[model samples]
Every structure is written in structure tokens, then in C-alpha cells.
Target: MDQTTLTRPEAETTTAAKPVILTGDRTTGPLHIGHYAGSLKNRLALQDTHTQFLLLADTQALTDNAHDIGKVRRNVLEVACDYLAVGIDPAKTTICLQSHLPALAELSMLYLNFVTVARLERNPTIKDEIRARGFGRDIPAGFLCYPAAQAADITAFKATVVPVGEDQAPLIEQCNEIARRVNAAAGREVLPEAQALIPEAGRLPGIDGRAKMSKSGGNAIPLSASEDEISRAVRAMFTDPEHLRVEQPGRVEGNVVFAYLDAFDAAKEDVAELKDHYRRGGLGDTVLKRRLEDILQALLAPIRARRAEVASDPAQVHRIISEGTQAAREVTEATKREVMDALGLFRL
Candidate 1:
């Protein structure tokens, strides 16, 4: 053996400050500014301190994108590219594909046994989704089982922490409920208790200032949007209708321009001044919108640069996801064995 062959404890610190956290986004379209501000950027910071698992949720996505299988398949790579572009270091965090995790699928099946339909029906998030989609009197079976699938995603890795927005708290609760039931039925606790890291950024609204941002809602400014596109989007952003006059006293408290400034601008004092000036009806919406454009451009430029670089070499991108899935596969498979034995689904 060569003298330089082994690197002993000279490698790296094994202890992480944060526990493993399971978090991800569904691939309906390109990740938007809202997603980046609300969660993606926080995830980047967590990679250094936490055992983070960033999943590209294609399976969960299929619940809605089922009709557009091509769209779902296409967005998988695009979403991975977006993640990488946004600084989700694959080296420090596991970037696995959700559909690749069979254990999660199995776990979902087992969890369904414990949850009553009434309970799933009563979930606030589910009810909101159903109403939003106008699924009155006709709900997809997969849509109903979404929370059960979510339990599998969280428990498969035995994740102790899950980063979720406030709206999704009920879903995480459902995951814990399934964990408790499955563990009690087995006469043992196998799943790690999971907690939520709700970032203070909260759920970002659309550029139109219409509640939550969504592709279907036609108001999202995607992470991969071109400079011209971003400019167009921001210029047209909904400002205080009362501030029709550039010299008119503008309200910044609920102004979409001010909200975006709060989320993206690092200079709080400057933003505060801008808000006050606008509130006094001295600052114009165009001026504020321009400042917002500058801030958003500053925020998205690097993401675009990185996305272009990774897009040029998609094979490397795919390889990273493949490696992550392989690593997650082993962990999930072992958990599935425990799950099957608990359910007496094992072979002699």
C-alpha cells in the first residue's frame, strides 16, 4: 500500500449541525421566483449544516400531470437543472428522484390502511386544493391519497425534520400520524419522529399579487425566465391602484412591489425608505418597479448562469440524480423490509 493511499481523519467533519430534512417541489413547471424566495434559497444554506434530501417529486407530480406525462418527464431534468442552477450542491446534499424510490410507494400503500377517508377529506390543505381545482363532486383517487404518499416520502428516509410552508403543516401532521399508527401496530417504533422547519419567508404570492403563485394561475415569474421576460413581468406587476399618479401617495404595506422588495432586497433600510416615500405619494410605481427589477435581476443572474452551464452538460446533471437515487434506494429498501415485516408482507 502506498503511503499516500489513506487519508484517515484528515477527510472532513462527520457531524452536521442539523438533522436530515426531507423537502422538495413538484415539477409542474420551472421553479418560480416565489419558490426560490420561499424555500430554494433556504435549502442551499441548509446543505452545509443539515443532512438535506432534495427530491424532484415526479411521482407526486404525476397526481396532477398524469395527463401530460410528457410534460412531467420533460420537467424532471429541467427541475434538476433549476435546483443545481440555484446552488443546491449535489456534493453536500442528496438530489434524488421521487419516482425512483420504490420504498416510498410501498410505504404509501401501508399508510393508507391506517388513515380514514374522513380524515383525509377533512385536511385543510386538501380541501383548499380541491376547491381551487374545482374538483367538486369529482376528485381523483390519487389526489385523495396525496397525503398518504407524502408520509412515505418523509418516513422512507426516517427524516427527523421536514421543511414545509405553513399551508402544508396539516400534511406533515398526517405523516406523523401515519408514523405513529404504523409503529404502534408493529409493536415497535421504526420511524423517526419528524418536525417542520417553516421558514419565515412564508408562501410568496404571484407577481399579480393574487394570493399564492401558481403556473395554472398565470402569474409566476420562473427562475429560468429570461431578462426581458422578468422585466416584462415585473413592470406589469400590480401596484397600489391608488398610486396611479407617480406623485400620488403610494401605499407600500401591501403593495406587490414592496412585498417583492422585502423578499428579495437585502437592503432593509433602503427598502424601508422606498416604502415610506411611496406611502407619502412621492415615489412613483415605475421607480419602485425599476428598483424591484434591479433586485430581481441581481438575484436571478447567477442562477441563470449556472443553469446554462449545467444545461450544456446534462449528462453530468442526470448522473448526479442517478447517484443520489442509488444512495437513497439502499436506505429506502431497508426501511421497506421493516415495513413489510410489520405488515406481514414478507415471504417465507
Candidate 2:
């Protein structure tokens, strides 16, 4: 916890009076287009209006990826590269490493006492994730207690705003519950409750038509995917199977291609017209896929190029992370001290 701040032009500093926002990605893998459509796009806008802190949740990634610590370690930089490539300016948003923040871990340990294992098990977000991972009776302790950990991450920064998917609303609720209990114990608001800011775009479906686009599921198109990779993913996308002929009417309700179009295509009217044509028949899946592929390639080419350029300078990336982590350390430490003092912990 060295307090190291990278020297920057005075003009680059953001106002400290803005509302604090905490949002981040688990460093399990590189971010994908789904991330862009869902949270990243909102983050880009919020950084200008709020004090944003982006955490590389390597500590949380260990809940499932403990077996492959190397993967988590390696992707910390990869995720950071993706963030920069996607236009998350470090000056506007503090991008910090989660494992580097000792205060977060300390707060998590303290907050755990305020919540019960039954309540944690009842968390919809945690339950769904457990089912999806098939953890059953073998759920990892870290994974089970992640709601508390998330509460720590949120309250440690006193983040009033957190951008997350709709499915993650319960976790925010759980975090606020912990915050309230701690405040009640302290006889004052030692930690601020957070609100979940779910994106309008919601969750993006995977190419295979899964409800979620995830790297572990092997259905995601990474932001750094090559043109050929994007094309291949689009081509393999799940569409209406019964709409075999171009002349036959098709269904767009569950079509993954249309889902992606809704998420990424800027021309809403054009997408609507395509959807109409798709539903009425005379439009082929290949045509829709081709259009989606073109849009994706155009969208990702610049990001891929930028990611490559940024990644080429590892020292600069490391410095950005180090500086951000240092700044975040100071914030978390101050909050931890406040909580400890409120709880009448021995300081000497």
C-alpha cells in the first residue's frame, strides 16, 4: 500500500465532488462485445459524470478459477488492455487491481458477520451462478460468500452507484443490507448503501443462443477477436431453424443474430426493418448473419487494433494499474479506518 500517483497534466484531473461509482470485471478472461453492449458502454458515459473506480476482480475470479491462478493473473493485464482499448481513460476512471486492495479483504471479513450463510444461499444471483456452475453441495466457500465480498468492494469505496446487469440486482440488495446492518451497529452511517444501475441493453445472448455471453461458456466473441473470428462466430450464430428457405417466414423472437443486432447495430430503424423482413419471410439467415458480421467486424476492428497497440507497451499498462490501485488503496483504507473506529476496535 504505497501511495503512488502518476503525474498527469493538471487539466486531466476530475472533480472530486461527483458521486462515486464502483463497477468492474472479474479477470477471468478478456472482455467481449456482450460486455461492451451491457456495462462498458454505460461506464464510458458515467466516468464523465461520476467518480468511477474500475476494479480488476482477480480476488473474486479465484472463486471459480482457483485451479488456474495463472489464468486469472494473466488476464488482469488482458482485461486492463481491453478497458483501455474500449476508451476507459484512466484519468477519468480509476482502474485498480482488486487483490492489491487489502482494505477490501478486511472489510469483507468484517461484513461477513452481518450476513448469514442461509441469506447468502438465498441470493438469486449467487444461486443461479451456483446452479450454472454445477457446484451443488461442492460450492466453494469463496463463491458462496461472494455476496459479502461484493458488499465490501462496494462499501469500501462508499460507492453510491454500481453498474451491473439486471440479474445482478440481488447482489446489490445484499450489499445494501450489509451496509445498513453495519450502520445500525455503528449508530451512524459508517458505510453508504449502493444502488444498482442496470444498463438498458441488458444481457447479451451468446452466439449459440445461450441466455448469457460468457468466455467460460465458449460462446463469447472477445473484443480482441480477429475479423475472421468475428465472421466465424456470426456465421455460427443460432437463428430460426425452421426458416430454412429465404421465401419462408421466419421467427425473430429467439434469434441470436437479431439479439446481437439489437445490442450493437446503431441504426435502430434499419434493424427494425430487417426484423420485419426476417419475420415475414423472403429474408435468409445468411443475409442477416452477413449484415451482423459486417457490423461486428467494423465495430471490433478499431478496438482490436487499439488493444494491440496498448498491449504492446506493457510498462505503461503496469504503471496505469499501479497508480490506480494506489489511489484506490487510500480510499479503501480511509473507509476501513472509519468502520473500525465506529465499531470501537482497538487501534493501539
Candidate 3:
């Protein structure tokens, strides 16, 4: 066992060192407000205190984007920019590209022995992904095996804390199971179990009132969306479908505009009053949409400006990724050696 990796979460002790947090995004597209509300904001707040590692999961992205490798490659930088634009300081957070660490692949191969095809199929996260992709019976082997791969990512950094949304809690649970199994097999604890730290109100509904906001859904507002783009998205947002006229009382429940307002609008009393007006009638959808647009514009303006500033210098962004990747590679290499030694692999 690595005594250093076995540190417990401090109990009633302010002087204890901050917990290490590992979280990140897949580089399939630019992140959206859903990402911000879910984990990105937590990253910004935790980066200054915790040992944070953020992964641009291009290799995981390949589980789905094998045919369109270009799209995943193109958005890696865009995702990094979004991270910086939203106040994830490179100086504080180590942002690494997943494919840059061959050790992760090696670790995944070793971790696979601890997991099973039946267990991977039962993973709610993978099941959801399979359904969302409409794969039915044609699921790719890589896609099916990704949970083990993800376990490798978590264990490689010896990450004790994984910040994720509720939907991904199962992934953390799976990692814990793998950790316990591997340690038992080796007759000692080599890997530490990771705990899931879910943020408050982590999941946000899409503009279309869908269950999730994602690039494939075409209902997400990019964190770097322009004012015009934001306005258009807000205008097109889903509202009470039964309320056809301004005089018709609307339903606040499940309205996308109200959901966004509740998440981002700081004027809680005003929003509550608006909800009252909306439900009582005489409030137009246009008025509600316009209010959301104004709030969104105010919220996104600085992020957009920062993204533009960062995007203007592509080389600097690459350097940050390159440097972080190198740092992460060193860490994973050490982890790989530990695993290899425990499994009795030849030193040569």
C-alpha cells in the first residue's frame, strides 16, 4: 500500500491538507452551461485549494468518434480554452490530454483483469451511453470496455476524490469495485478507492427541455456563445406548450426558461415573483425569454471575452496542454511501475 495515497478526508480539522480532486471533460465539443453548473464551477473553486487534475479525454472520445477523429482533435483546444475562460487557471489545475499518457492504456489493460464484460454491461453510465447512441446490439468493443479504461484514468493519478454529476456516480462506484478487487488479488492495497463528490444541482436540462444538454442533442448553449447566439437559443427555448396566449396562465414546472433562471439568476426574489406572474397569466413567453437572454448575456459576456482572448494565441494554449501532459505522464509512469511490480511483471 502507498501510505501517501491512503490519507483520509479530514474530520473537523481545518488545518488538514485539501483533498485531491480528479475531474475532466471529453473533447467531443466545446462545453456548455450544463458543464458549468455541473462540475466546471466546482473546478474553478477547487483548483486553488485541491490537487486537481483535468483530462481532455480524446482517447475516450474515440470510443464514439472513431470515424470522425477530426472532430475530437479539433475540440481539444476548444475545451481547454473553455476551461481557462471559466477561470480554471493552468497554474493551479493540471490539464492533460488523455492520449498523451501511454501508461493509462497500459494501466487499463491491467485493470481489465479485475473487471468483467457482464459488469461493464451492467454499468448504468455505459448502458445510458449505449441507449443514447442507439447501438442496440452493435456496441463497439472499445465503447463497452471504456469503464475499465476510465478506472485506469482514476487510478493512474491515485485520485482520491472524483468530482462528477449524479449520472456518473456509478462510474466512481465501479472504480471502487475495481480497486477493491485488484487490491484483494494482489493481497495488499495498491489502489485507493475514489469517492464521488457531486456538486449541488449538477445536472441542467437542455433548452429543448430534454433530460440532458449535449452537443448531439443540439439544445446546448456553448459557454463561449456570442450574444446573438445566446439570444437566439433563449428565444427558441422550450416553455409551457399549452400556454398559447399571453393571457393563458403558464406552468413553471418543466419550463426551460425558469430552469435556467433558477440556476443562473442571482435575483431569487425577482425570479420567484416572475414565476408567480408566469403561472398567474398575463406574462408572455417573449418577456420570460428576453429576461433569460439578458441574464445569460451578462453571465456569458466575460467568458466569451476570455475565450476570445485565449483563442487568439493558439500556441500558448498548446504549451499549457503540453506542459500539463508531461507532468501527468511522469505521475502515471510511477503508478504503472507500482502496478507492474505488484502483478509480478518482469522488471526488464
RMSD values, in order shown: 4.4, 3.2, 6.2
> Is candidate 1 or 2 superior in lDDT?
2
Writing each residue's lDDT as its tens digit, candidate 3 over 1-348 gives 222211223221112366667778889999999888878877888877787889999999999889999999999999999998898777667888999999999999998899989999999989998998999999989999988889999999888988877788999999999989888877798999899888777578899998788866788999999888998899889999999999999999989989888888889999999999988999999988888898889989999998888888788788778878887888789889998888778989
Worst 10 residues of 3 by lDDT: 5-14
The models' CA-based lDDT, in order, is 0.81, 0.89, 0.85
- Tell me model 1's lDDT, rounded to 2 decimals: 0.81
Candidate 2: misplaced stretches above 4 Å?
1-15
- What is the total number of backbone clashes in candidate 3? 0
**TM-score, each model?**
0.91, 0.95, 0.92
- lDDT: which candidate is best? 2
Mark the regions of model 3 whose C-alpha exceeds 4 Å error after superposition.
Answer: 1-18
Return the TM-score for candidate 1, rounded to 2 decimals.
0.91
Query: In angstroms, how far off is 233's CA in candidate 1?
Result: 0.7
Go through the candidates in order and give the clash count of each: 2, 0, 0
Model 1: ten consecutive residues of lowest lDDT? 2-11
TM-score: model 3 vs. ground truth: 0.92
